[model samples]
Target: MTADLGARRASICPEPPFNALFNIRMPFIYPTSQLSLERKTPVVSTANVGQLAVDLIIASLSLQRVAILESGYCVPVVGAREDGQKGITTALELYGHPGVDFVVIQQRSPVLKVGAYSLVCLDARSALRLQSRKEEFIKALLNFIKDSKFGAVLFLSGVDLSNRTDSQMTTPTYQIRPENSPTLAGTALQRLSSLPIPKYTSPVSQEAQPAESSSSTPFIPGGGITRRILSSLPSEWSVPTASILQFVLEGDNRADAGLLASVVVKILGKEVPQWRQPGSWRDGLFGTPHDQTLFG
Candidate 1:
């Protein structure tokens, strides 16, 4: 699937302006408030563990919903609110407190992958549409960071634990910064370098490294679009971008989420508040206990 998607993507042209792609909706207005989004940071989470970590952050901080991003790139989804609110939630939304210096983007659905529907015998037009959606999504996100004048952007994701090498066994967390990042050196992001966490080393063999690796982008196995998204950001933009990665396997990851969230808070230089699990997690997050009677 990766190879197939790569081949299709190679022929595609660059993305157009973001205004032509999607519309952003901010339903709640704070007219009399002193809240300002300018120069604030944005913590963007990918699917899986990253999403879970963002969920923990939102609940812990008691952040408010700020915006709903409408994009065709993600698979359509709707579910009961994670915050135990009265309404349903969509695939993508933003949350933040006016007093906070950072906003969190919670992605509730995975981005559409053309390979998943390839076997469905999609027509050429349909295939093109799928590919465009992904490109537009990335472009829209990058454009948002630029338009909003964010101080910096942090991306979060999880890599496959099985891909870890001997050296990586020491720590479950790692980070990746764009090679020669112009904006990260003097910023708070620079503090991440002093932490115990090591820089992410791609597990891909030198011989089989993809073309993107030439630009010094880390290949993150099972990280879902993280590498792709980071690679898309040009260093000249100087947005002080960095990604925090956790090594993880499938199944219960609540503990992993908590640990990752702590690391993120440390990087952001924020006080770690008492942890609060989202209400949605109470709904059989670990699944129903096995019936003891069956063992008899």
Candidate 2:
């Protein structure tokens, strides 16, 4: 029998209630860590929280962003790859020279810039070694974002494309938000749909799923705690967010990055700069190394 997609969705990620509280629980078993919460703050410079000056923040919570950087170029890494935190200090790098001028925040997470947008190459894996420091790191990251006064935040995540199909569709996998429509949420979704990439359709086939499961909690699976942090931002903050998750077959994802970047630029009412074409991306290093490296 085909299990309903809504049923599978509810089992996977329940919708948070109107007055729901934050779920501080970690979903996976973490190895022991020596660092304490206080020690983690030094990685995040409280001095220049809003220095980015960009109007939008684009993030990848899948943690693959780390490997793409470790390879030194946008080329695909051969062998098995995975996601999640590596270590505390391992997570902090203020200035990175991985062929790109990516600014490290809170020690390990990296951020790059394109015109008015700030692309956050977040390694969700690093947060694992944080231990009791997770909450503190999240607070610091949020404060830094708040200081930026960005109009909106967009999280670009990757979902596993195993067992089933549609890996090459180029459609975004999931978008997280409250059940009821906020004006900004509606506007953001509408603008995002206007982008030229395909998006996931409701009611996936039942044979595609592994099995039925249940979870009372509502959350983003691969996103790690970053989703929780983004979801918990208070309403008064007025910074709307849209997380565009794409499906990948576990290799180089530069093509996915290009599709996501284009969607993001469109959502922000900006054009994909003419120089970002796939043909020129290899030589147009400043354009988008993330995408160019994959197909260029």
Candidate 3:
């Protein structure tokens, strides 16, 4: 069935756009003299051809990242605690059905949708492993850009605390953005800046004081593919926007992921009840630290 489908698609697919997009080259090989001469036509793999078509179809959808959450803590080899993934799951659960679905580019990555917004959870282990043969990955992403629409992409990941400078004080959340960005990207930055930090309220009195925030655009070391993918996407689509939140890698990364999700929710102008409180789970399997201190 797959072979038949491939053949039917081959008969109808146009050559120009696909050739240019996938960098497909056509070269025929020929052998020796008249008696021994053998002619061979260039062969294109059916799987590759099918994948391109699939990318085109999927990318054509109008999808936006009203809110996006990306995490790399739960990789295959690490088998370490998946703090980031768990955090995202918990946040989505708080908001009822988050449109749970999977869009398999290379591996079956999950996509959570809330109204017009989307939250994409990516695992860097498989993505980096597949980078060596990036034909499908790149083609799928490019097609997604060409077909769909994205308001802005928010990259969320944990960073190594040791990389912090003296000026920084504990688990600082840094925003990394390009010098010039698309409208959506710029909007993301604007919204984030405008969002009022959670304020402390006195029980007796009704006074509220805003929370403190730090500013820095430090390079995200050990960020895997999350940073690279978002940063390079704008160059491809022209109108796309992207931003990154590299939280300190120490302690409970699950809480870190939730913290990342909360920021996204706030920027979208949504209300989060008890947003500052740390997420608690009874498993105690990952051994995540209980400190949940978001600010210094």
Candidate 4:
């Protein structure tokens, strides 16, 4: 399953989203009625074809087009919602670093009040099902990417990957880290703190940092191989929660998975310790912790 280490993704490289100096509009998302609410729900509705919903998810990945992240990165989060705001925040904090170029989009105010950039709002799930236009879905997605300035995108959501047909465009794992190169693997490990990791815990994944650190999770190295994780625990740690993140695909066991989240939440980092398999994680440094929440 592993390939090489020297490969580079023209999409995600050492540069930021707006690499060029000037106020160049990297891309644009054409609005569509298809993005609006359906006819079925007229009376008790405050949503659409998941328009703002999708936008919020996209923003969560892009950093609102600033220095923390690039413009092209994206992800779908069927699991995300105004309630999942903290997790979304954790993901953004985890991924974006002075080192990371990813962003986090969250609905800060009520729909009737404050507004946010790089983000769109939508109604709840039931109202949303009224419009499942896959074509419109992929079109808006494609158009958004073509118009944006960034290179790659990660379309996420609770949506199933195997069931969908047109959602073919995406960044492959090999791009994150060439399947073969140990050195490159080493670099990614160090840069892990660069992206968002979401704060909630699991028996398995997502980035883990303390509840406070989740406010701005950063990827870092150290920790250890899946089997050796117990050895890497900070000497004075009072709390620890283990989980398996959805994005990590090396098919790692709970050990690596746990540490991965610990890093996102606790800022625990070091070299990419040995792992049960490749793609488990990339390595980097564990920076200081930030203020955040704690969950059981």
Candidate 5:
């Protein structure tokens, strides 16, 4: 059978726009790649694809125009703890270089949410019957990263089988709450890992009870300027874990966003120079991070 390019069309992924999510300004770095490092194809776990997406966006952008229709769903990892869910995002934004496009966030309500990525949402506050101030602050920071014209994101709500379809894409995805992903909530990225959507039945947890929250504690702290400008986030959005990457690629839809991201990485790795690792650099001259090849 012959391949059909014209007959095939890309899915119209409608995620959030950039700049809408960020409440503060942060620095970002966008490096241009000279060598492609794909001596072998890159395989990722859908369960942890959140991290893969970050790597892909950073690497691909350095080489060429990069776009991801991230439809990886997720479960919860961390939330607004009583320790005062304030300023954590502030600590993170200081790290990124100022050159991104969007931090798209798409979801299908309680169906599925990204458990790995760090973010703020109304759920965090409401989980304790409090206003979602902290979640809003995180959202603001996310918008800043996306609006920089650097990159974009497509956050999808809901899960597979349960929702019946992969992406209903109700709300738009934005970078208001995007952060250094694959937070402690997610597992580390490895060549060998599980994919998203378990092939077998996962052990069901017993009935759970949530911790109590204090209402007096504003969803955020007493930062007058920060609090004044940012609005509370709605309970609709969520950040997912990075592990979903591998699963989406190998899931029911072989050609969904997860597979597309993998294919994109493979394609870019083929032509780009950075994908190929350069020889070890001068030992002390630069003290730069070396590329740790996974498998040959």
Candidate 6:
């Protein structure tokens, strides 16, 4: 019965186009509402910390779903609705409050990592495809930001805690801005600079840094695509962009998400509202509770 159901579903769902990554098809953004996004700041989420922080922001600010982002770069996923919404949710979606100065792009699934899987399967072709997909995705996203006329863009990510230096141990959060970005004063990036958070310095030793020492391109270990996206921006680009990141180890990171979300709120100069955990977090986030009867 299960095999039959799986076959039926597979037949119903169309297969992704061949050479889709190589062809570089542009992602489609479908707006569900009449919300004007012009001049609004956008927060792009990456890594676990970023995703969870975005979730907290949506719940706290009561941000509504404004658009759905259809992209081939991400692994296709559909599951129960987030934030207690009625219908199912897809891999990527946009959320925002009407009058709020900032919006968020929540990525519910990780980027397609065919290369990692290819190692196990020993298929070199899959590795090449992964690289192409990632590059195309970055190009598509940057083009969208440039055309959207947004006031600024913020990226959130998590750095590997193991890479932290002794000095960095005092502060778990850090900020990175492209040196070439002509960010003016009073912008969200500048506002974040005013905070006590330390600027991210590459952990690589000076001897090893000579090869990748461009100040404009930062090294962010464990921050998936954060550095790539920032470095890919053209030097002549006018949009202001920055990344806020936290050093975290994989585990129950709910507390880390809260702290990072607070920093984001501060950067926007908005009063931090009472954070309400989404229904998904409260219910089965970690998994079903262990039965005490086992111990007995």
Which numbered prediction scores highest in TM-score against the true structure?
6
What are the Cα lDDT values of the candidates?
0.77, 0.35, 0.33, 0.25, 0.26, 0.79
Residue-by-residue lDDT tens digits, candidate 4, 1-296: 12222232322233322423232443323221122211111000011211222232233323122211111223322233232333222111112223333222222121211111121122211111122222222333334333343222222111122322233224111112211112312221333335454332122222453422332222212111111121222344222212222223222233433333233322223222332321112221123454466432
lDDT of 6: 0.79
For model 3, residues 60-97, the per-residue Cα lDDT tens digits are 22111122211121121222212343212211100111
lDDT for each residue of candidate 5 in 74-119, tens digit (9 for 90 to 100): 2323222112434211111111122322222211112132222223
Candidate number achieving the greatest lDDT relative to the actual structure: 6
- Angstrom error at residue 227, model 2: 2.5
- As for candidate 6, its clashing pairs are none
Ranking by TM-score: 6, 1, 3, 2, 5, 4
lDDT of 5: 0.26
Q: Rank the candidates by lDDT, best first.
A: 6, 1, 2, 3, 5, 4
Candidate 2: residue pairs that collide: 84-125, 85-125, 85-126, 91-107, 91-108, 92-107, 92-108, 93-107
Q: Which RMSD values do the candidates have, in order?
A: 8.7, 18.5, 21.4, 24.2, 23.1, 7.9
Evaluate model 2: give its TM-score. 0.40
Global fold similarity of model 5 (TM-score): 0.24
Quote model 6's TM-score: 0.82
**lDDT tens per residue, model 2, 176-231:** 54322234444334466554554433234434433221211133333334344544
Count of clashing pairs, candidate 6? 0
* TM values, all candidates: 0.79, 0.40, 0.41, 0.21, 0.24, 0.82
Candidate 2: misplaced stretches above 4 Å? 1-131, 163-170, 178-182, 185-190, 193-219, 273-296
Whole-structure CA lDDT of model 3: 0.33
lDDT by residue for model 1 (89-202), tens: 778887888778898888988877641112111222223233445656777788877877878889999999998899888899999987635557666566687888888888
